[model samples]
Target: MPPALLVQATAVELLALYRSRSASPVEALRAVLAHVERHGAPLNAFALLDEERALEAARASEARWARGEPVGRLDGVPVSVKDLLLTRGWPTRRGSRTVDAAGPWTEDAPAVARLREHGAVLFGKTTTSEFGLKGLGDSPLTGITRNAWDPRRTPGGSSAGAVTAVAAGFGPLAVGTDGGGSIRVPSAFSGVVGCKPTFGRVPAHPASVVGVPPHVGPIARTVGDAALLLSVLSGPDDRDPFRAPPPREDALYLGALVAVDAPGASDALDPSGALDARFLRRVRVGVSATLGYVDLPGDTRACFDAAVALLRRLGAEVEEVAPPFADPGGVLRTLFAARAAHTVRELGPEQRALLDPAVQSAAAQGEALSAVAYLEAERQRAELALAMAVFHRRFDLLVTPTSAGAAPLIDGGALPPSFAAPFSLTRQPAISVPMGLTSAGLPLGLQIVGRHFEEALVLRAALAIERESAPLRAPPLRAS
Candidate 1:
């Protein structure tokens, strides 16, 4: 197959081709590397590209396929890790110059370890905001990661590089960490699919200081590909004290479990994959345009209304509902500020000077927080979680616009408003899927949120939307 078509293929498609000898891992890696080299710099998508090691791994995968002895689920697929996740052989700078790229970079984060174990070729580490502390992609370490659709715009972040890479066809699979809107924000702006699974669903080693709000999950071109990646990403890791093992039956039959099970069903309603529409029949979806406080830009509101119309046509009973709680931006900022302060407490003056101004400001705010204030924020978070739990009991899913606006200019003043932070605070599973493009041709995303530990239901709903929505067009990359 030609490199253009090969680069655009999904992970599932690549696997089938590899097994049939119609395409090889080496070919895929070369195409991806070439694509990255030609367009990656413009987007600032990667912090480090391990070209030599990627080629070596790809060659070995090709040999395994030649012998018909592929190692594991993702045997020959090329995967990228967000710089926030440690990769054994790569320096995980975490989008900060304060982190020394030296020895003792000896361990992989749980997600990366799992991918390595599954025989995935780890080709590169993508960029992020300094310590992933901001919603926009610009960092002191890697500068700005731009939107794939238009280089002049910011690709929403802290999972900025991961989304840009996926949208630009540099790779089919990427692991993105979301705390606040990190993953889904960029996914929305980049016009790709990103899932922030229930907290602890995908284990985190050296757990984030930001607490339970941070989740590690998949960002991909399609929901099915994200599901395939999540199957490997989920499960317990001893390193993460909060990690919980998904139910055995769900893990064993992921594909079937996600496709036909009814909302809150105890038993599989249909395991034959023939009940796609029925899966959503009478499903109660609560639509909150602003989640009661976010300011919706005109374009995003129009796109979200269109998405509601689409869901109605798909057999879901959609209603406009007020979110149960007021905006929790204050609670989120308090916790995040404390976390940011802890992350940089030990930095020397020289190292501190290298930090992003936003990171510095957040740390200062955290330093000024009183013990009582911190405790109050925690209490509020617990209350918010309880409120969402109650809301979920009445509704099968919550639908909202992923961001308040389309991708903003790279030089625009602030990060676009997003509804993603509340779900992060609640530790619920939420996904951002492309709804449609704006008049300017930039993408918009519709978010589907489910209760904690309900990823299967969330993925099923996202897949239904994917099926009914217009297919996503490839970005007009200069390299392509």
Candidate 2:
């Protein structure tokens, strides 16, 4: 394959090439690196890119494939970790000057450890908001991560760099964290697929200081790729005391996209494969463009309506539903602010001076909040989660616009996640899939939210959206 085409291949497609001996990991990695070198600085998608180690790893993977002794599910796939995740040998500065950039950095966050064990080639760390504290791409440390679709626009945050990298063809898979729409928001803006599984589905070492219970998840160009990465990411680690119980030992998330009891079905769900859309026939989808209280602009609302119609066309039993409950963003913000407050409380004067003003502002809000006020928010949070659970009892899935609008100009700030933050409060499994594009060619996202621990259902529906809707086109940023 030409290098341009190679740079654009999805992880599964790369695997197919490796299996057929038509390409090697070395070749793919070189093409991707070259693409990144040509276009990376403008996007500001990476905070630390280790070309030396990545090339070395890719060459090693090529040899393993030649011996037909692959180590794990993702052998040779190029993956990037968000800066918030501790990676062996790489300092995780987390887009904040407050963190020390030089490190003996010996530990790997749980997800990074899993990816390494699975033979993924870890190339770099993507940029994130300071401590992943905000919803836009700018950070005190890495400056701004721009949307590849339009350099003037922001690629939503704190998974900002992950989404831009995936969309801009820097890499096919990226690990992103979602405290409140960090993964999905960037994915929505960058026109990729991102999933925030049920809280604790993927273990997190070193607790989060942002979400009620933050999640680490996958961002990818396709649902199958996202599922493949998620399968590797989900499990228990001793390091995370709060991790969810291990999923079924044999769970194969990619299999969920097939919608049938059949062997060797996964191959048919890839980019060049026949997608099985049967699962949608069994899904009851409830869609609300506006989650009752938030207002959506005309373009966003129209795209959301069209997404609903597509689901109906694909055999889903779709209904226009009332918002499940009032927006719970206030409760989310209170809890979020309190966590940020606790995080900055002990920082030295110099460290505090280095923090994002937004972070300091949140800290102040949290410090001023009485324990009673914080406790009230926590109680209301539980109530909100329960209400959403009851809402799910009536429908298998709820679909909403992932962001308030498409990617806004960088200085204007990314569209707010009014539609997304509430689900974070609920800790449900939610995914953002590219729904459609606006008249100006900006991409819009449709969110598929399922009952807690039901990521497979969400993945299944996401695949349906991809197969039934117009195929997702690459963003205008094509580098070769």
Clashes within 3 Å, all models in order: 0, 0
Prediction 1 global C-alpha lDDT: 0.86
Q: What are the Cα lDDT values of the candidates?
A: 0.86, 0.85
Model 2, CA-based lDDT: 0.85
lDDT tens digits, residues 91-182, model 2?
99888888787788999999999998999999999999988889889898999889999999998888999999999999899999998889
What is the clash count of model 2? 0
RMSD to true structure for each model, in Å: 3.7, 2.8
Top candidate by lDDT: 1
lDDT of 1 at 43: 87
Q: Give the C-alpha miss distance for residue 13 in model 1, angstroms.
A: 0.5
Model 1's C-alpha root-mean-square deviation from the true structure amounts to 3.7
Where is the poorest 10-residue window by lDDT in model 1? Answer: 256-265
Q: How much is the lDDT of residue 188 in candidate 1? A: 93
